[model samples]
Target chain A: MTTGSPGNNTPLIEARGLHTFYGDSHILHGIDITIHKSETVSLIGRNGMGKTTTLRTLIGLAPPRQGTIKVHGRDIKKSKVHKIVHQGIAYVPDDRGIFPNLSLYENLIMAARSGPNGRDDWPLSRVLDLFPRLKERMGHMGNQLSGGEQQMLTIGRALMTNPDLILLDEATEGLAPKLRKIIWAVIKQIKKAGIATVIVDKDIKTLLEISDRNIIIEKGKIIYDGDSEKLIKEPEILKKYVGV
Target chain B: MEFSFYLIQLLNGIQYGFLLFLVASGLTLVFGIMDVINLAHGSFYMIGAYLAFWLTGIFGSLFLGIVLAIPLAVALGFVVERLAIAYLYKKGHLHQVLLTYALILIFDEAQRFLWGNDSHGVDIPAALSGSITLTDIQVYPVYRLFVSFVCIVIGVGMFYVIQKTKLGMTIRAGASNRQMTQALGINIERLFTIVFSLGVGLAAFAGMIAAPIDSLYPGMGDNILIISLVVVVIGGIGSIKGAFVGAMIIGVSSIFGKTLFPSMASIVVYAMMAGILIWKPQGLFKSA
Candidate 1:
């Protein structure tokens, strides 16, 4: 698949000088990152290094103590989660955040809405088509699904919102190899559909193969941000930072 | 007991149960979705009854009084949720209880200042004032039957909305996971306001409808509050279906206890609650 290149088009999301803390412990220390239209960026880092915090801050789940976050060039540093989402962003948390009380159909249909400026690119039918596995379990409650199916349902639910960008945390954790391939293929399809994505996954090889740009975070700071192809050539950087 | 006597008691029990269901349903949903232990829920019921009594005098019709009173009750609910209950969402249950208990006191004082402490009786609508003769010496008031019928209609409507509508789906989702609901672009704060107001409306509506059958007085909400809490516990904390079943059980059991064992009438409902808890610690239905 052809990847998005750096252009003069306005970026989808931009964060500068993010300083986020959890209670007394400061997690993110002045991290800056940018995502462009139709771009796929992989947020790669070792565990507890602030990849999740970065996504959470960008989505407004974890507000930075001192920073500016802009979506489509509009400042939204203090916006609530729902308001930020209305600007065409969806977040699939690491836990997969499925509502156990709701069935598969309810889960998808509940989030069905046109994107910003009434963009209806991803509908319920389109999402179901993307994951036929989900279509079969429409009547099943969210808790009844296996780990792989829950992940698909979460992704499908996000698409139902018709978002311009999606932040996926731990997209393929604990899934069998076959299920991982299916999830990767779906991610590729999502990229083809021209929706920008920031994926945090443990698979370095898969990340290199699919992402347009790669960013490495070390202790809440952006240590590396460059082309994916170039990052693949530098094994020492991956070993020293990502522990791959 | 004669067949006619048993029949009258049975109808009375069912009617009382229906009224209790209205209050208990709101209590359960509010607790389930918002996680707020509102000790003042019954205050809405008291306000509803007083509103019915006061408005009926002005409107010259019980039906009109109820209709006008509904919106007022809903507005009060909205204001209370925004000004008070909204802050208690993250607070511990102890704080929630303290704040809401304080609200009960405030509402009681407000009621006294506005409507006085005298007991008031609401006249049944002239159209429903007549009674239906079941036997030679047994008769049932049409208004009581009307209350039951209205409750049944509302119950069915509630079931339809909760089971079939998108709003209901979102409500269930909100109850299950509030954070995820927001992540889906849902304005959850708005949804919480709606739920809280609706709960208040339902509780107040129950009070309004029951006013014609039961005498209205200050602190009338206190007894119903305890009873409704029991129903909530019996039905499970957040299950509407459980509330319905639990309310009906208590309603009938209390009526029978009053008739058959007058000395133990008060203890019957408590005993039943104890037995049920011993058997099913989670209540009759699982929390939604």
Candidate 2:
């Protein structure tokens, strides 16, 4: 839980003046963000607008060119991706890079590392409880699972890490509406459990419904940052930035 | 040939196949997990055999020599991984091939410098030197059966470790997705070092056990390395099960090929590899 109320000062993760580049091309430019405890924030933008790039940089996957990334008030600028993960930040990449040949149980067990926070948060049983679908298909290889099941497995794997904050890149990018709703429901449930979430997706309506704040990005910069209700009221801004 | 003769050859083939699995599993894991293509892995096997020969001669105890050879081989494996394989992690595949090739030369020369160029024979332990007669037409070496038993035990133990333990999960995950596994908080460098050494250890152990039956020659490593690669390619790149299955297929096929067409036996293995690759480009079980 945050020591101070929202808009006062305390935030679980804060990204200030973040800049990222892939080779010579600049991807993220001077992006600032503050995510409070137990809040679900959605990053909405069209393709190539640097939504995923920001998440990647924050997670230390693509090292930021210039930025201050603070998790639980600790600076993580020079930290490696695994170190960041050890600090209780879990990232589910867009590709859902599941261990394709490994059985679903193997994938979850492998990713489960006891952080400084301890092992009680996300044990195998807890993870199976979170995603019961994973329990049913525990012996199935990753590639053998359907798209929806893979997505669930990805989320379950992250949860097994006992992460305090979970980053979902394109949470429901290619899922059916029914699956999308299921993912959204799970996200809401995760938020209720006091785990901070930052989800990147194109489903603006669904994202807004679950998110405490919605940040609209254009050309790697936040054009609009405010409460989800305010974001919904501003249809013109949403249409300009997000196609939906 | 008679059915009994065929049966003996079949059993011999299985024996050979299991030995190959022990060597190839480590090679495949090193290749898959660390992405380090070590042409010198076979050199460890050679060193193991030589070490066993010398240690057994000195200690006058075959068990002591075999046990001592394991740690020495592992230490050598660690040195090789640190000195050569570590530097090649981010470099392209071509560099890996060249460096490991160079390593093979260095190891061979070093081996020759210490042990001379003559082929050396290891004495079979008295306890296992006997033979079992299956029929009037045939007899099987008790040592060969012992080798098969050792390989089978190692195989089963490895299977349990890989399937039941946390380390196995990490190994499989690293083999499957290197970057993702690292991102999940695994210190990939440590994992690489451990895996590379473990692989080297297995290859060395295989060599030590096999030395008494097969003479130790300078270029023996080269022959085994090629066969291991063939096993890896046929079984599937990173799949452990693939390595086991491929080794058996190659082992049995080679035995059968020799029986049918003596001169073309080696060619059959390569031909089988080519066919398998053509059918499955990613391999029999491509890791996700």
Candidate 3:
């Protein structure tokens, strides 16, 4: 499962006209977003704009009913969540999803699986290097961790999977300024490691600084798509779409 | 002499509790992981005892009978799970209860149809067919002690699997957050099948081991099924440790209840359940 090196002209993900639902309420309607290898993209939208739905649909959680999704040129619209995960897309859900009963070490180790290349890319040593606080609290249960610590553990666990791509939903919500800085720094390091990332967060300035591209969604539609710098230049687009 | 009588009864209660743990551990896991309220879990117990009787008669060795009965019980567990319990997973609790209750009736009728409506008995192995004198007037059966020791080994093994191993770690994770575990690339549905089957085997093995002391009677499963449910509810749902402690508590209380108040024996465990529920609705040791 050795993938070609990054920047091969082929997009890592290609979602086209994806329509998703939460029971009767239609969420994502024909939304399309493409991501390239090792590149960081951010989904920017107001609350309930289906930013999270796109990520979920990509990972086969709430799979799109009305469109097609391909991961690395392979059709995956109907794959099970575990199969989709095995295809090397690691998702960090908004809830952080730390198993409360597992210790911090267990939480981190349980997600340990080799990437497509079968390399121990993000081992425990690598994770501990990125976030030393996790090292200090290795023996503590997931429930014992603070909100910020839980968030870091979530990101760290995702890395432990050695995935080809990572999707983050509201990764920095409900965190203090200091912790938010750590998250941003981690994002930079993730990019430097040549791992593709799709992030959803509220801080427009940070997203603009860290991401190569920006996508704006509204009412389950990709209303705006462009480079990060271009997205911020159009304050009216942010005002009109995101209600800024 | 009177104190020895009470002491013997106390050990009997503990012995019974261990047997209940055998059945309840499996019941609690299946219910916890799949949320299927399988009322027919104890049918395995009944089948186990019957299998012991038949196999022992065929082989002329009770020990040989116990050995062969293990895999047979596991196969039956797999068959039941694959045939009926698998379908009720998505249904409401009421529907689940109705389906499993229907299964219990089917099992009971099937048992009578196959083995007749009379009680069957098994003999203890020659090695364990002796007794230990506890007092001048009292003696404890060696077979019961052997049963208790086997149960202790299984309980410790179950604990080690759940608490210390990678598979146990996954099970603990799956118990808490099924969706998140799926997202982590674990084949959770497959895990369900194995766990469900493992549970069935435990319940059946309990009956197989206790066959010598407890007669194989029609509707034996029904009474034990209800009691095992009580154990599950009293212990936290899906908790093995809780099941163990809950089994001991119910076992001792019922023994005393039967001796001190014969009329209330049937309902005494339920009375204790009500008190415990009021104190900690989630049971004493909920899986964190």
Predicted complex 1: CAPRI docking category: high
TM-score computed on alpha carbons, candidate 1: 0.96
TM-score of each: 0.96, 0.93, 0.96
Query: Using alpha carbons, what is the TM-score of model 3?
Result: 0.96
Writing each residue's lDDT as its tens digit, candidate 3 over B1-288 gives 388789878988999999999999888888877788888888888988888888999998888998999898888888877887778876889988888889888988988998899998898888999999988778999999999999999999999999888788888888888889888888887778888889888988999999999999998888889999999999999888889999999988988899888998999999999999999999978662
Give each model's whole-structure lDDT. Answer: 0.92, 0.86, 0.88
Score residue B12 of candidate 2 by CA lDDT. Answer: 83
Query: What's every prediction's RMSD, in angstroms?
Result: 2.3, 2.8, 1.8
For candidate 2, give the docking quality class from DockQ: medium
Model 2, residue B225: C-alpha shift (Å): 1.0
lDDT, residue A115, candidate 2: 50
What value does the lDDT take at residue B149 in candidate 1? 99
Off by over 4 Å in 1: A1-8
Highest lDDT model number: 1
